[model samples]
Target chain A: MASDDSVSLRVTPLFSLCQELGARFTPFAGYRMALSFPAGTLREHQHTREAASLFDVSHMGQIVVSGPDRVALLESLTPASIRALPPGRLRYSMFTTPTGGVLDDLMIACRGDDLMVVVNAARREADLAHLREAARGHAADVALLEDQALLALQGPAAAAVLSALAAGVGDLPFLGMGPFALDGVLCWVSRSGYTGEDGFEISVKATHVEPLARRLLADPRVAPAGLAARDTLRLEAGLCLNGADLTPSITPVEAGLGWVVGRERRLDGQFPGSDVLFQQLAEGPAWCRVGLRLAGRAVARPGAPVLDPQGAEVGVVTSGGFSPTLNQPIAMARVPAALASPGQPLAVRVRDHQLDALVTALPFVPARTVGRACSGPSEPRNKP
Target chain B: MSKVYYTEDHEWIRVEDGKEGTVGITDFAQAQMGDVVFVELPPVGTVLTQGEQAAVVESVKAASELYAPVSGTVVAVNPDLPDAPGTVNEDPQGEGWFFRLALTQPNELADLMDQDAYEVFVAEAGESAG
Candidate 1:
């Protein structure tokens, strides 16, 4: 929806390479994304669990914030404690509205004198405008890295594959970022990713991405993965997608992302929606996000009505699909806080029938991310 | 061997005798559907009308409805499908058959496309869709 109806969709830096791999392209967030490959999204998903899978995340927006007042200006816009962020570490945070609604979720990395912010592709245009406008007369400068491409190499074998191409890449701590040379090409690599795996998000120039991607793909343990597999992998790890789960009406507390709000900023939080978010955190939100395990094979899609045991509509599903890892139907829903528990009985209305659903603990698959080592797409390391 | 008839929705029916037919999704449909995860089939002896929804084939990404190609009574369903639907991706036209029909309106077969016409139909539809 970001692009005008008459405008043509843009392709990523790896578009031609994806095509060479027999990728089926689909329009995604104004970009021509590779939805799946010849092996299919499901097959790519299972392969990532056992080996490494490279995902072209060039659609994501990367912004560089530099200046003495950058941290102050940014902290004033969100609940993150930017002042406490040490250099070379990544922090997951969100941009919120005055009424506690989420605008978008993002990853903020402290890169010495500057900060690097990666936001969702669908919200990039808005995020850029918001950042530029917010900086205004402040000493902070916001600039989009237009020539850069972001690629995520994820899975259990991700570290080994990357380490083979770049020595010492495996030693970077989880959520840490620094300069690394992949086959002698300097790139900023971070030990972070959306898939709950021990992986790296490599930020390289657009010209270098294709060759780097090809280099990784050349590994027997690494293969090209597409957006479809990325979605399923994140869902199985209980990670929320931007448009489906997080929205302008959903608060961090209600979305089970209270930790994303800096704990140190609680009493003195000054960002938009701080009061509302802190109040909900204290009293607990009336509605809370939860994971659902469907009884039958039928997938419970997003927007399906969640019903209570007495057959009354209690909540709504925000994200749902057939989890390839679990080989069963799974979903995420916003239900009453009282019903947000492990093993709580619930039902989802799919088409005409009500399928029995149970409230399961999130991260249907266990997270394998490195603390100082490696991991998978995740449930925010809550250790569920 | 029986002459096979195809539907726009991607179902196929092979009729050996005028009244008896085996129904399943076409190979083109299976390839497009991706990895089959689970399947839901109507019970044996269920009566179906032409174009009526008779079965559901769920893939990792979505669920697709398999419609009855011609009005008939479902005398049998592939017993192995519900437990191992991935067979649909492997042998969609053969071992992956969904149901057998005792046709009530065998005349409905004339309205569907044959192999040659269906190939052209699929080709044009795919071109327009892509």
Candidate 2:
């Protein structure tokens, strides 16, 4: 179900600019998003790892919960320590079902009195409905920020590029958020990105997004990237894609996202599906997510079978691609926890070929974020 | 002198002796499929039928099959493609050729579109697909 080719398509604010820059359009979550620019996906991916890339992530759903009870309402929705987060801080979280399955993964940023939550494009409608239904008699004001556009400027050189345009941007911590003036344009910027790079995700008004995009593209270190590069970069970072690696039937514990369930939430158990999740935490989920380094040059597309050493079908590949950073094929799979140890031998069935693969550590390409403790490339750990 | 013919699938054959031709995907095809990371060309002496999948082209986004434009036997593949598959995206119609084929049914060429006809086909296809 990774196909985002919806029947009808709407264009984003930067759609025309993307076309002018020689973009290949792919229908994603009902929007005609660029799959890649003239530089292509591979080059754009490499460029982001080295310099910086400007991605028009306008299609992502931005919802802001503002009011006296905004923080309380958000705390009741997810398992992250939202109540404990100070202003201008961000936390990665997910909505879990009563069965402990993940409904959707979202980014929650705490503004002074408002909580800004960014959900995946495909799950936006459902997420909005769920939030609204939960806020019937509550004091929280649930509204989608459709009037705003989200742009991600990511890579190792991302800070240098943004610091050149905006003041005080380089001072923000890894998950810090604040408002900054860029050439007279006000923008809500966050020192974070999905690509595991030292970058910023800027939320700006729809009418003002194009000029800001142009100004950023004018920088020699910044180039246009697209959804394809976005997907590959997240894969390299070992991030899960909702509807693929995560779904309503896949719990966060099983998805190897136990990190999102903070210690306070684990004891209080106020979130949905706390019972099933607590059980899984004490025991273990039958199937768990694992990082893999494929043997050959071909990519192991999602839905490809994962075979045990004895050639028995044991798992399924959730996400995969040729890692431009690693210069080899890598994939993530859901397999038995017993088979998920580091250096465990396995094989992936891609078309008519069965390539030998090993259970490798995630974040195949180490993250280079600023002011953050990034994991080493070969750090062998059983934890997520 | 060799002459070129085109297929609706955006494949091209440069026929020199009318019985054998060098085959490669058209520039439009390469552009349609982003940057090619791998091209799975058939081995020499492999038999192919017209409209059959003769090779696989894997881009960063997805993989697609390259259909044979006419029936032929694989003579040789571009030796440089395995390591430098980006050539298919850079010079798709020239040195980036996929393979050479000895035509089994040469008359199948007549059913394909000529250069002018293909230009028109690409125009209409691009408009409709876009």
For this target, which candidate reaches the highest lDDT against the unseen true structure? 1
| Residue range A1-384, candidate 2, lDDT tens digits | 123434578888999999999887888888999988888899999999989999999999999998887866776778788877889988888988888888888889888879999999988999999898877757989999988999999998889999998869999988889999876789999988889778999999999999999999999999999999999999998888998899888888888777677678888888788888888877878878888999867889999999999999999999998888887789999999989987999999988889999998777777777777222112223363
- Model 2 ranges with Cα > 4 A deviation: A1-7, A373-384
Q: TM-score of every model?
A: 0.94, 0.95
Model 1 chain A poorest ten-residue lDDT run: A375-384
* Residue pairs clashing, model 2: none
After TM-score superposition, the amount by which residue B58's alpha carbon in candidate 2 deviates from its true location, in angstroms, is 0.6
Residue-level lDDT for A6 in candidate 2: 42
- In candidate 2, residue B121 scores what lDDT? 88
